[model samples]
Target: MKNEPRELLNNMFSAAVDAAQPSRCIAPFLPPPPRGRTIVIGAGKASASMASALEKIWPGELTGMVVTRYGYAVQCDRIEIVEAAHPVPDINGLRGTQTMLDLVSGLTQDDLVICLMSGGASSLLSLPLDPLTLEEKKNINRALLTSGAAISEINCVRRHLSAVKGGRLAAACHPAQLLTLLISDVPGDSAVDIASGPTVADPSTCADALNIIRRYGIAMPLAAMQILESGAGESIKPGNPSLASSDYRIITAPQIALEAAAEVAKAAGIPCHILSDRIEGEARDVGKVMAGIALQVARRNQPFKAPCILLSGGETTVSVKGDGRGGRNVEFLLSLAIALEGEDGVHAIACDTDGVDGRDEIAGAFISPNTLDRAWKSRMNPQASLDNNDGHTFFGGLGDSVICGPTLTNVNDFRAVLVLPKSADHQQEN
Candidate 1:
């Protein structure tokens, strides 16, 4: 606990990632590298790394393809690694997606489709709606990103709108034993919600997708709307018999990640309290609540005592009403900072393990007693930054943005609030 906040923050983040490491998650569940043709592949932020892990564990001449976010790709042999857009689909994603469908087109039941999927696959494995072009899908994706819809809601719409997502990917490999290993980033960790459940059966209906689109006010193109409204194409449902031969497993998830972080803190003599692995809400709103909790610990010590770190996970949403470039984590931390209002003896960190928070390069941010003071001296207004939805700029101006690039694995957000009782020495220093 005596370690510097930055060092402790990095350790906690690393520990969380290690807890959900694909290599560990992919081991026991790996089928004996199918006797017939063992095709290994998938798409998402962690897919390329998962593929690499599969190559090491499964002793077979595995060959297949996987698409990951542009900067999230890793090197692997036999299995081709394709880089594409994420949270938004693009032309490269379209090409890689076509390859997946084509790869499974002629495969026999003897062929094993080892789909290494994780968060972001829904966008990374993009294929436009039949009548709508890729550009149209892109517009809808942009709308969805800014719409502040939950991951599940956005993916519900994505599954029905795409040709490669939903259950089509698995259906294409019909008769083949499809084994999908997922690293869940969704709140509930539903198989169908992860990466739009590409290889898993989806129970979400066209109406479900349409309802979410309208709920989020995503500006669906006329073509997109007609597709959903007309029900021209549908995603896999619960009772689909084609899923009989498919296999599904959640290899890793936010729960494990949060637990691991808690363990590390406990070992370090800091009491770690887990809020929930499924926590979700408006980023700033969640931040306020977390801040309230931290204040309780700092002021009242009702829930926990001093020398404790409050931790929580799961994705949060940011409804885009402001012209800010910051991501959910920063937004959350900024809100938390504002709530604390330069309170002493409490420090915190909020970051995405995937190294990307929302669409920004910063992994997250650090908040100390002087956070506001630093922002104020820099001529940056905390409320103004928050108002503009530009948390990224606020922290960036203070040089406090924690940018780790892409760690390539996502288990959602990791928030740590360090609560310390006011000390006489600290008060004197202040």
Candidate 2:
């Protein structure tokens, strides 16, 4: 309840993360145990944690496998946990996907298959459709990521190119009652976009993938391009027979996470406003827009007045043009700092709930009224750093980078802007 902006922001972020944790959100949505075998299969940053949670509460015996990002594995007595790469496909992921498909195959109508999915599954459940090698898929993934493509567009291509995604996994589990539990990180929480909808039907076609590639100027491999061009890469459409026995439930999403953070702000006796849970754009651009909103609240106390906190959750993209470290959260904060130009009464924090931003272990960063002054004292150039996409280094140099390691769960980006009353003295250092 104190007037500590940084601590308050951090607490809010933590509340959001805690609210989406598999242990807390997965239990209520779990399906009843099947009469025959219970097989669990999944892949994502949070899949292992979901498995662990399900194992603890599931009354029936179960066995299966799930793949999670490196350093995200949780021990489960019944379900085997495999660690794999994320945002890019690797050999481990390919093999894991094949194994999962094999495990789900040959199931009976009386059996049940539980599929746990989350944000990183698109990369972690990597099994390219034949003729498109793993290396080729990896290259396409790298290109799409650096091209600043939206998550949905990137996933459209992935679904078409994957052998086990886009209802293919559900196909493998046909005849069995399949239940998919998802922790959504995508805008709108579209099931088909989460982890490319491994256990759900995909309405997108190969032509959609081709359009995204053309729109983004993404270079595709010859085989991959041919597959899309010839419609050989089309995903399972809605109402597919294989998916008839399958059902999916999104247990947690960005909106839910944002509301949890808002509750924290309310508990602290501060009015909170959630801008949107599905905001999307280039990271720096989003930051500039947020800065405009914060400035309005600080200068004129318009909209919602001062001494209030603004919360939002969503994923933003970054087109890599610089040689420095990058993360959307830090990029957003860096741009916000530049736009604010040392405006008093404005303090903000931006972090990825997964505790990893871009390729760095740092979650995100913080910015206060003195952020620019401190960077100037450290001989850092805010504009130059931002131009180079070096937000992690920029904030790290100022000792303002938020480092929380891996939170083991991800909803998406968490942004909190705390605007104190204009009359209050802004002497506190964060």
Candidate 3:
């Protein structure tokens, strides 16, 4: 309940994450029990938690399996939760995906298939198409991630290259009625873009994937190129009959998470303005723009005025040109700090709700009015750190890194900028 900058920002973030937790949001969207069988299958960072929630609430007997990222598994009475690597595919993910496909095969029309999907499913549900080895797929995935490509573009390529994605998984469950409950982490919450739309039809084509590869200059493997060039990797189109019995509901989304944070800010009597829930771009570039907006509100009192909190949610891409040790959230914060340049009365926090930014287990970092001053005092060059994309090191040096181990939910990035009035005399906390 503390209104101090650091504590308030952390509280808002926690609220945002809690609002999207599977247990809180998944119950209302559950489908009725089918006459024959209920099969639950899914893949994502939050899939296991969703399964656990469903296991607790479903009235009828259900059996299933779901794959989640390492360290994200949860216990369920009937459903099995498997752990797999994320942001890149591994043998465990490949086998898990295959097992899911096999599980849904030959189900009767009286059966019901419940799919719990969230962010990170693209990598967690990995199954490379023929002629494309898992190693090659991993290479392509790594390239696309570091290439500054937007998630939708990256997922487009992934859908084309995967054996189970882009509605193929839905198609595999043909006779059975499929109900997919999603925790959206992508901008706009497009059904086809969520985990590459494993249980929904895809409107994107192989040519579109090829165009994204060219746009990002991602080095594609020979087999990958062949799959795209020859159109052999085409995904299930929107009108495909296999998706006739498929339906999906976005149980929670970035907007809902942002609104939760806004409620926290409002409860503390601070005016809160939601910038947008779908802002997208390079992390540093987006940071610069946000910094400009914050500065305008701080100096000119334009926009939303001082003593206000600015909130936004979306996935930002990092080009990873520098061997930085942080994710997009930290990269955005570091750039924001550099751009703020020790501006007074401005504080901010940027973190991924899933509690892993980039490859680090840390969520993200916070920046205060004297963030640069503290860094300089510690012999840390803010500009140099930003250039090296080493936000984890920079923020960690100042004890500003926000660490919350694996929050079993993913709703993309959460950002809060607190701008106080110039005459106010509250010392920055974190």
Q: Rate the local accuracy (lDDT) of all candidates.
A: 0.85, 0.91, 0.92
| Candidate 1 residue-wise lDDT, 322-411, digit = tens | 888889999999999999987777888889888888777778888898999988888989998998889888888888888878877888
Candidate 3 residue pairs that clash: 327-358
Task: Give a tens-digit lDDT track for model 3, residues 1-430.
Answer: 2488999999999999999999999988887899999999999999999999999889998999999999999988899999999888899999999999989999999999999999999999889999999999888889989998899999999999999999999999998999999999999999889999998988899999988888877898899899999999999998888889999999999999999999999999899999999999999999999999999999889888888999999999988878868789989998998899878889999999999998899999899989988888999998888888888988989999999999999999999999998744543432
lDDT for model 3, please: 0.92
RMSD of each: 1.7, 2.1, 2.2
Which TM-score value belongs to model 2? 0.98
Which regions in candidate 3 have their CA more than 4 angstroms from the true location? 424-430
Instruction: Quote the positional error of residue 118 for candidate 1 in Å.
Output: 0.8
Candidate 1 backbone collisions, by pair: 324-389
**TM-score, candidate number 1:** 0.97
lDDT order, best first, reads 3, 2, 1
lDDT of 1: 0.85
